[model samples]
Target: MTGMKDVEVVVAHSGRATLRVGDVFLKVDGDPANADIEVQAIGLAPVPTPTVLWREDPVLAIAAVPGRALGALGEPSTASPAAWAAAGAAIRTLHDAPLPPWPGPDLSDIRSKLDRECEWLLANAVLPADVIRLNRDIADAALRPYAPAFIHGDLQIAHVFVEHDEVVGIIDWSGASRGDAMFDVATVTLGHEEHLDDLLVGYGEGADREVIRAWWSLRSLNISRWLIEHGFDPNVRGCEFDVLRARAQER
Candidate 1:
C-alpha cells in the first residue's frame, strides 16, 4: 500500500478504493455545473473531496454516503424509471466535462499484450482457443480510428444511483478516459431502451454521437477479447470484459 500519513479510508472497489485527505476530494466535488469536472464526477458531488477516506487507489471516486446511498432507492432495482433518469442526468453532467488521460493499454497494441497474456495462460493450461479467436476479431475492430471524447470506460445503470426520481450521482469512474463518448450507449440499451431516451435527452449537448458509437463498438470487441484471453471465474480485471461482451450483443 502507499503511504498512509496523507490518506484515510473512504470507499473500496474490487480493484481500487476512494479516500479523503483534505479540502480537495479526489473524485467528489460539489460542482455539477463546472465543465472542468470529469463525466464520472457526477457521483462524487454528494461526497466531500480532497479527502482520502478509503485509503485505496481507486480508478474512480464517489461521495462515500453514510447510512444509505439513495435512501429510498436502496440497492440497484429495475423498478424505477426515475432511478435511470437520474443516472442519465449524472452521466450527462459527466459527459459535459473534460476527460482525463487514457491510462490503460492501447487497443492497437492490445494484440501483443493479449498474445503474451494468452501464451502465459496457455502455459498454465488455463487458456481456451475459441475464446481467443473471438477476442482477436474484437480487437481488430476496436483499433479503427475514431473521434476522441470523454468516455466513462465502464458506463452502466448499475454504476448509477438515484435518490428521488432525480439522478443524484454516478459511481465507478475507474475506466474514465478520453475516447468515443458514445461508448456508454451500448450500456444505456443493455436491459431496455426505456431510459435511453431520457438519458440522451438529459445528456444535453457537447457529444459527437457518431464517434461515441464507434467507440462503443470497439469497447465491446475489446471486452469479448478480454473474456476469451482470460479464463472465466471473473473476479478480476476480466469482469469489465464480460460486461462489454454482453452489452455489445444487445439489440
Candidate 2:
C-alpha cells in the first residue's frame, strides 16, 4: 500500500469507478452486491484472476494481473490470432466450471427489456426506424431459452489479459452470472468481429453462428441507451452504432 506516487483513473462514471495505483487496482462500485459477485466469481473461475488484496465498503483493492488487455473496442487488435484463441480457451474453461449460485436474467425478462429498449429507441429517435427494426428482428433469435452456463457477463476484449500469446487472466467479474454461453461468446467478440473465427477455433466447434450474431444484435440494442446516458458515443467508428449498421447492411 506504500509508494502510491501516482494514481491513474482506469474508468469512472455514475455507476462505478476504477483506479490504478502502482501494481494494485482500486475499484469503487455503487453497489456492494457487485463487489461480492466479483469476489465470488473470480474465486470460481478456472482462469487466472487478479488477487483480491482487501475490501472495504464500496471499495475493493486487487493486485494487478500481469500483462495488457487483449484489445480495445473500436480499435484493431494487435494481439496475435493465437492470443485471441487463447482467450477463447479461457472462456471455455470458465463456461465449463460449475455455474454460480446467482441467477441471470430470464428469457422473459430479457425479452421485456429488449422490447422496452426498442420502444425507447424509436420514441426518442435514437436511430433510423428501419435500422432499429432490422436489428430487433435479428436480436429475436437470442431470446429463446438455452441451458445456462457460468458466464462472464461483460467479456469485452479489454477485460482479457494476454501475454506471450496466452491468456494470463481476465478482469472485471462484476457481471458474472449464469447465462447463455453464446452471450459470452458474442460479448467477447463484440465490435471486433474479425476475430470471431480465431476465437471460435479455440472455443470448440459446433457453436451456433446465428445465435452468436443474435446476441450481438441483442447486446448492441440493450447497451446503447446506457452507453449514451453514461456519456459514451456508440457512434464512434467500429463501436456499437457501427456494429448495428453493419448488421443491417448484411443480407
Candidate 3:
C-alpha cells in the first residue's frame, strides 16, 4: 500500500547519510552488515531539519508508507496512554538489547563540539570573559562518565512510532551507537517532559532519574552553545546563554 515515488525524504539540516537503501525502507550505514532486511520499514522525523539526500542504490531499503514520521503522534500526553506505554516498553527493550560493538561519539566527542563552539565564540567576543570557565566546567562534567550502550543519539518524541496503542516500530537509528544510554534519556527528558514522565512510568524506577536530569540539563547547556555559535543566524543562543548564566549565578 506504499509507493516509492510518494515516499519523499527531506532533511532540514545538512549531514551525512545515516542509512540508504533502494529495495528496503531501513538501512543503517555504520554497520552495514548488521542491518536487518526482514524489517518491513523504518520511519524518522526530522529533529533539526535533515538535508534529505536520495540514492539510486540504497544501502538498505524496505517497503513503507511515507506517512508523517513515527514520533508525530501528538503532544507528549495527548496520545493514547496505551501508545505511550508501548513506546516506553519498546525503548526499554532497546536498552536491554546487547550492546553493539559499534562505538558512538562520546562525551569527549561532545567536548570537541563544545570546544569548537567555545573557540569560535571567544574569537568572536560573543562569550564574556567570566563565562568561559563555567562553560568549560559543564563540558568537563558531561565528558566524565565512561558509560556506553546502544543509544539512539537523537532519541526524541519525533523519532518513535506507535499503532493500535502499541509501539510498532522505531525510526531514525541514524545516531544509534554503543554510547551513553543516559544521553538518550536526557534527550527525551530535556525536550519532551510529558512523554518522558509517561516513559518513566513504563521504565519503572530502575535507573536514577536525577542522573538523567543532570545529564539533560548539562546537555542543554551544550546544545544551546552549539546552536548559538553555529546554527542560529542572529545569535538566538545568546539568549539561552544568558539564561544559563543567570541559573549559574543563582546556584
Pick the TM-score winner: 2
| Candidate 3: worst-modelled 10 consecutive residues by lDDT | 37-46
Q: Model 2: residues >4 Å from true position, as ranges?
A: 1-4
Which parts of model 3 have CA positions greater than 4 angstroms off? 1-9, 16-60, 65-77, 119-141, 221-251
Candidates sorted by lDDT, descending order?
A: 2, 3, 1
Q: Please write out the lDDT profile of model 2 over residues 191-243, one tens digit for every residue.
A: 99999999987899657899999999999999999998999988999999899
Model 1 lowest lDDT segment of ten: 66-75
Clash tally, candidates in order:
26, 0, 18
What value does the lDDT take at residue 92 in candidate 2? 91
Q: lDDT score of model 3?
A: 0.51
Candidate 2 colliding pairs: none
Question: Which lDDT values do the candidates have, in the order given?
Answer: 0.46, 0.91, 0.51
Q: Regarding TM-score, does 1 or 2 come out ahead?
A: 2
Error of 1 at 43 (Å): 11
Across residues 1-251, which tens digit of lDDT does each residue of candidate 3 receive? 56554433432233223323342343434444334211211222212222223323335444432323334322333556666666666666666667655566756677777767656656766657456546555445456665565566677665665667666545555566777766776565444445667776665556556456555445645565445544553223324454345435533
